[model samples]
Target: MKTIEIQIEDYITNDKDLISVIKRVIKDKKKILLQAPMGTGKSSLILDYLSKEFNILMAIPNTAQIETIEKRNGIFCLYGDKQQKGYRSETTVVSTPDRLLQATECFKTKNIDCLIVDESHELYTTANYRPKFKNIMTLQSTLKNTSILHMSATPQANLTCLKGFYDIFIKIDSKKKLKTSIDIYDMELNPSNIKNIINKYKTNNNNTFIYFDDKSMNEELAEELNLINVNADNKKNNEILSEIKAKNKINENIIFTSVIRAGIDILNEKNAVLIICAKSNLTTDDTIQLIGRFRNNLSKTVIIKNFKNEDTEKNNQSYEQILNQKKKYLKSINDDIKRWEENKIKYTKEDCTEIKKKLTELIEIFIELNEKGEKIEENHRYKINTHRVEISAYSQLQKNKTKNIDNMIKLLEKTEAIKIENIEKKDLNKKANKSFNKKIQEKSTEKRELKNKELKQRIEYLSNNLSTLQLELFMEGSTLKTLEMTLEKGQREDRELRDALRKTLSVVEPKSKYYKTIQQIKKYITNDIRDAFKYITQRELSTCKKDIIQEQIIRNNISWIKDKNVEIATDIIKNKIIFIRHFKILQILDNYGLIKNSSRISKKILKKIEDILIKEKYFDGIKKKNYQKIIMQDLELIFNLSRNNKEIRISSIKTKNMNIENKKQTA
Candidate 1:
């Protein structure tokens, strides 16, 4: 919980032995595996060296390890935080696989001095969904300067047999096999035996920690304990932990549970109990880790409730076989050691430590069997409480049968094994004939030389044709690529030019305004131009137009100039036309008088305008019946703007100019 400011250099003097070993292996670039118990300070020792000795990139399973480095101010390291804890200055906790992969990508761009993997056993069992270990391996391959320091309490025994790691340093403590004193209590009182044992402990009214083999069993026992009361006191949170600790310390009454396994520590407990049923078969790894909780190194009681009716023969046989296999491995090594001088082979202290650890496990198994008074046999029966149960050692041995033997049993069960009871003379004759033919039928195979010759000929022919096609395809592709590039370039240039012209036109005033201004000057209008000025405006033309004037109005227009008597403003705009016609429209406007002075709208004119609009095929091929309403509207605007009335003529305005001819005339 406290902040720790740790420097990489600080580890140079700390845990010197572990640091020395790590340094030596890394210097020589050797693959090393450190085998230590859970509470022997394995993670701390290696982590300390890695933190101080190098720029560490540590990958741990959970948050606890990451928190340690974060509190210490470890420099430029990667860790994981499951509790949403934020990263420190030099520490980044990659809590998820996606984040871890991102960190790996960053690592590729730079150098990481070392990759320290905690709980390294997770590497072997990693599935497709869990790609953290796989990604770490990938990063490892990319980092040439980086060294890997993998730490685990349980490592795969077969890893050393793999290539590229032949010369591996295995440091394990053989003599330090975890030892704890386990006891069995016979609660002989009453019909419900275990209940009596609980009652005896409840009388004392202290904390009781009980362990069960399975989750369901633990729940069942907890429910039963909940029902019991002692002096009106209820077991609550504070009382539960305290009772567990006391029971562990005193090695007395406690509820049994599976939580005693793994990295949990119970050093402060006065006593503890471990109840092993006939169904329990704890492996060495699990047993060692569970026993590690008894940290006091003081005498502890492990109450194993051996039920009277349980059958433990099968488990006992399995335990013995594992013990025998280990013994065989050690005996072979010992025999080699006796003849080592003749063989000219030598081993160092480290090698001895490795060998001893392996052998000691075998020795410990034998010791457990002796202590538990377990008898090994081909078949055995035992009494648990009141019932007799049989345990056959043959059940364990049956697993070793071959696939053929398994098939034979299934064949017999299916009546396909030629049962004597179902066999007839014809059946016997048929089977005998099949067997005779199979033995002497002379099974022939293809000739080696003929097959090889045919295969080689086909291969050569295909190879020649493939090469020819490849060359032709390559030449064709190159030519095609060049043509494509040329075509694309021309198309791109055309688009660019059109885009530029469109942009220019967007900002320019409409050409209709030029004609409208002149018309306004001649109209004798006194008031400021109203919104209707917009109606007379024409849409601007695109850059590709052939005729500027026609495009100005007709290209995208709703009306056009009409009255032939209206004079053209020629001297100022000779090419411009001025007319007072019922300006026909192809598209209708909502309100013609409301149109702005500088805008373009398309609309069919009124009835009179429609008459003129039809002159240019305004509604060409359009059924009069289908769009009769819009057609009527087209005609209405034309009638309103006809020669008789509300006509508004537009004109273009200009600037004055002086000529040289005036001066000549004056002279």
Candidate 2:
């Protein structure tokens, strides 16, 4: 065992808030979520707080963060020989998520007392839970005493979406003074733009960080700069520090890095210029994190988007990928639900009701959290080391239907199409309905008006909650969602069958053989499905035709893209049934233009995409919902369905083959 030591200064000793919170969490042994602003010395504070007792395992995103941590700790603790890897007692072991997951393959339990996940927001933002998430979850379950801490620079930037699952929360307040005015410019990122930025900002004494999501883009841009380019891989700690600290440089030195905000932070006060290229497949949070690196500096941030001409940008454009995936997700669950039902997989109404209740409760908590923001600290019981502490944060946004009253009110007011009020309103002077009549019903002017207002608000709340419930019904990524999808798929498929039968009947006479088959199929549908499709082929003939066309579009649209020229297929899509197929976004633009020419996509396009995927007329995003609110639900639903579908298919296929072999042997 060796002693763990770190450099402590007067500023660190004086700052009681950071040290107190860390000590309190450590003492209580509760899982904490540490959130501090940029350039606040979070790593330094953490190092200062821990002594010889706590064995720490820190999972980070980039190796640059590892370098930074090593420099602060004055030693590295990688997963190899402890002595050889420069590991001492209470040394913080750091590695990227993928690497840590790989190294801990034979792990039954974690010996480390605390596990801290840096950039914790990535877990929620990703499409599904990666191997690292699974490993951590297992670690949580296996190591009963392991204190799992999820830390992020959430407040003033974004909320940690995964906060609901944890037991503790801590938000640190650090003030950053603007010594130099930050000038921000938004445009496309390209070679010409890069050259212009370099020519303009590359002064002799200035230090610049050109951030990129893509490694190739970072390398290419660095090459384009034609300067002394250095990154995390090509430098020593002292050398890099000296290079950065060199105040009298004749020419500007640059370090173009992909690892800007994902743990690699430099505590430097040189004239800093940030060229943040927000022009990549990276999410909005990622872009914000990158740009936030220069938040503490007298820095100028140039946000050059990854823009291209209309033709070139069309291929890699980010649109409604989730909504399209949601439909596929639903269809995938259909077979599994069917198989589960056959296999007698027990599910009860009571179970569903209980789950729904819990989900609703979580959602409401989140809604209140997002609305309340920092204000709700007084309302809720939060203990952070004897201080009334609150960080820039969002509420516990659980992946369920949470009610936001203001947002709900805005929605109800905007849409006259669907009145949210459930009450049957009579005239102010007229007799009240017996349903609304009370035992001692006496209506005064003020009382009546107040009652009416209360009723309206109640109705709006009901409407909002109902919409959330319905949308979230199939969106939560669990067996519950799969079951919901399976239950709804019957109706969805029935509608299609009805439309198919109707279309066939309309085109064919009573004497036609195909008409009889269609009639028979209708009978089968009626007998098999719950009387939902009894009169399907008769009234919904046009709807059936539209469904037929939509299904065809979904099926053939892919082959058309692969084999045929897209422009020539105008005749195939002449009926304007592109939006009908929720799975595919047709190039056929309306007044809003379904696809925008601008680098940053318009909100209208997003709405169109939502409507095409989820019901636009529905609560999913009709009232201007954020992506996290909508997409998390969709992701959860899709993940469960996709996972269950694969399992069921594999199981059924294996069983069928075994039965076939048995029958062949007997024969």
What is the clash count for each candidate, in the order shown? 60, 6
Candidate 2: tens digits of C-alpha lDDT, residues 1-667: 1111222232343576556656666666677666655455666555656534566666766555566566656644343222334223434567666556444432334366677776676555442224344455455566556677776654321232332455565654433322332333334444445556655776633666666554444444465566545554454543543543332232244555553354444444446666555543443344445545443453454444433323232233222332233223322223222332343334444332322222222112122232223312222221121100111111111111112222222322332111122212111222223432221132333454564465444333322332343323212212333433543454445544333332333223433333333343333222322121222222222233334334444644453345322221333322222222221332212223321221233445445555655543323213644432343333233223332222211112223544666588799
lDDT of 1 by residue, 1-667 (tens): 1111212222223446656666766666544555454445655664554555555566665443344445564434444433224433332222222245455544443455666666665454221124344455565566676666666655432142122542454444423333444334422212133334444444554434444453333333444555212111233343534443344444344454444432234644443333332122332223333445555442333333322432344323442353344344334333433332232244334333333322232222222122233423111111121000001112122222211222223322232101112211111111123432332222211233444454344333322332343323322222333323443344346544333323222212323223333233223221222211221232211111112323333421212113122222222111111111112231223234322232333232333444654564434434543233444433344333333323332222111211233355588
Best by TM-score: 2
Where is model 1 more than 4 Å wrong at Cα?
A: 1-18, 62-110, 122-143, 156-166, 172-179, 183-209, 226-262, 274-281, 301-667
TM-score of each: 0.35, 0.41
lDDT of each: 0.36, 0.41
Q: Where's the lowest-lDDT run of ten residues in candidate 1?
A: 382-391
How many clashing pairs in candidate 1? 60
* Superposed Cα deviation of residue 158, candidate 1 (Å): 6.1
